[model samples]
Target: MRMYISPRAPKEVLDYAQAEANDSGRHANHAEGSCFPLSWNLPPGADLGEYEWVLNGFDTKDLPSINLVPVRRDEPWETIDAHLNRFGAEYLLGIMPTLWQLEVRFHAALRRSGIPVMMVPPINLASVPSLFAQFPIHTVLTPLRYLPELRTLLPSRDPHYMTILGPSDAPIECSPGGKVSQEVHLVPGMVALFQCETLAARPTTGFHPSDRFIWEWENDRLYVTDPAARFTRLMLPRHYTMREETCDCGRTLTLTEAV
Candidate 1:
């Protein structure tokens, strides 16, 4: 079995994984060293398809784990409220297909401290202002297509937006006008176990590439290579123009603009 360490993981954890890989005669890749390998080949009879991605935090089995309460679209609001109140939910993470259709009462039913984290697709941009006024949504995860409208609609709420390529993938961009960041997972999967993150204060339209992965631009296309990940040289679908100069915010991380 191949194990990749998260960039945020403690030094001891990374060292242990490296030591184990070395002892087992498997090649180990780390962010501190040279660029990752470009090969995408797998060993004969080795199948990674059966392995499910899991995030293993520092805690052991004895510690209390996170409880995720799933709510169906057609489920009664009373039942949802009961579950939230029973679990003493601190936040609401919802996937809404239509933002305008969501009742304001649903948000009002939550406790005062229960911030909402909403994930929505490209919806009618006109409803954005009213939605924000009615719901105290702390964070929004949406597709790239809606960013231009969101930027205009929520200029003051710059730090609350994240751009996602798909439901399973990690966010491509986070907090547009505030601190821009992205996570590079060690293994390419819906859930990330080992990953590294890149952060910059007040980035323009792009982010700096983390040392955990190597990034290349080919004809306006962005391709990333994660040494510890199973997939090699994944290309981003978006076309971007690169800028090497310092940003107005004084951050020196290389910036890119979606073109």
Candidate 2:
């Protein structure tokens, strides 16, 4: 399994790891390198001083295993037009009839390299209750409420992962939607805390990209803008995507699936 620490330094990280390896060490909830430090994509955190299409490296106090892949904002209309003029075949095959080709480009690249991409969902820890309670379809990610760590799911099945950005010790579980017996409610803290290698899956049946796999959120610490306004004023489709794909409830990612 590939463990990704964060944007921290090597020596500092080593010290943390050494401590975690000790019997009397208090670093037990999660491993030192399992946590991947992430960077913000919205403005403020992302400087508007320059319009360059460049990416930044995430800065973590702990050393990260691999450099994170840069992501893009919503698929602007121009992005979609460019794709239609080029890979029209693949473009048409996409769920949304006029989605930006860049949406699927990340998945396509990762698929070719035989690696599942991880996407961090943008959500505030304080308002998490709203997310799971009124979770939207397609857009509402299927967090393996089984994992005990900080990771959460988003709309796209594009191997993209998101972090609701916050620390929580509360136990959370899933409650299936259906009849009395058909519908199931889950317990707290039952989800697996960490899965070292979840980004390994299949050749992907198709592409599923999104503007906000994470509900376009608020909270400067976790999301880009004010989520309350985004959700309330926006007339977006919950899943947002115009298509769907099959998934394994237990299996984490299709591209990073264990063969």
Candidate 3:
């Protein structure tokens, strides 16, 4: 069986999902296939069955609208180039680990608009500088732990932007000539969305929650309830502490530490 989880309180998430479902003209129920109504909620400990599929965030209906290009780390440059040229790709998106393994010539080909997706511990800290020097990446997604190192590596005069991966209580140091923002990575067991774009307008040094999701702190852990999430509640897999102070960005988004 396939289950579709929708937020109960935030009407916008449900409304958006329903709109997409309606636009696609798919009418599958909770017990049926992938298409499900916004009113459906997953009961506590609901039996998802042995091989059930759960759809959330972007549903099957949203697939047609998204243009995704898949590239393998081992794929030859000629093959990747063919796909890029065939699709008329404007930019390349890849994980930091994969980008580092790719040939330098490949980096040069897509350096114009390549955006590297980074994660904590997954990305090799030592190779970052070489990647930056070889590929002129203007945008990056990384975690708070690497911010200081990244700040030191970035060119003083170049414009850069970053989207932080998770919560942190440590002060967010500014980049020499770049902007920093925050975002919650929707992992397998959890989903979260923060105001990443709004925070980009100014520099901030603490963690904050966006109005788009409900934030809860309990037992030294942070729980996020995203209105657009497929799961009811997602507990972040880290210890956290909430601080009720107004940030320099003029918003009381609160501060939290992810340890």
Clashes of each: 3, 34, 0
Question: What are the runs in model 3 whose C-alpha is more than 4 Å off?
Answer: 1-138, 142-182, 188-205
TM-scores for every predicted model = 0.34, 0.19, 0.38
Instruction: State the lDDT at 190 in candidate 1.
Output: 18
Better of 1 and 2 by TM-score: 1
| Top-scoring candidate (TM-score) | 3
Error of 2 at 151 (Å): 7.4
lDDT of 1 by residue, 1-259 (tens): 1122124544554555445545756333222121222233444574555222222111122134311111222322332343345445444433233422333333444433364544333455666666667665554444334556677877776433333232123344444334323322222111111111233233334554444444445565554444444433444544545556554535344535454
Better of 2 and 3 by lDDT: 3
Give per-residue CA lDDT, model 3, range 1-259, as digits (tens). 2122223356665555456546757432222222222333444665544122222222234443222222222223332343345445443333333322223334544553352332323356666656656655544444445656666665462423334343222345443333555544332111143333333444443345544455555565554554535433444554545555565546655544444
The residue pairs in collision within model 1 are 6-194, 6-195, 7-195
Candidate 1 or 2, higher lDDT? 1
Q: How many backbone clashes can be found in candidate 1?
A: 3
Candidate 1 lDDT (Cα, 0 to 1): 0.39
Tell me model 2's lDDT, rounded to 2 decimals.
0.24
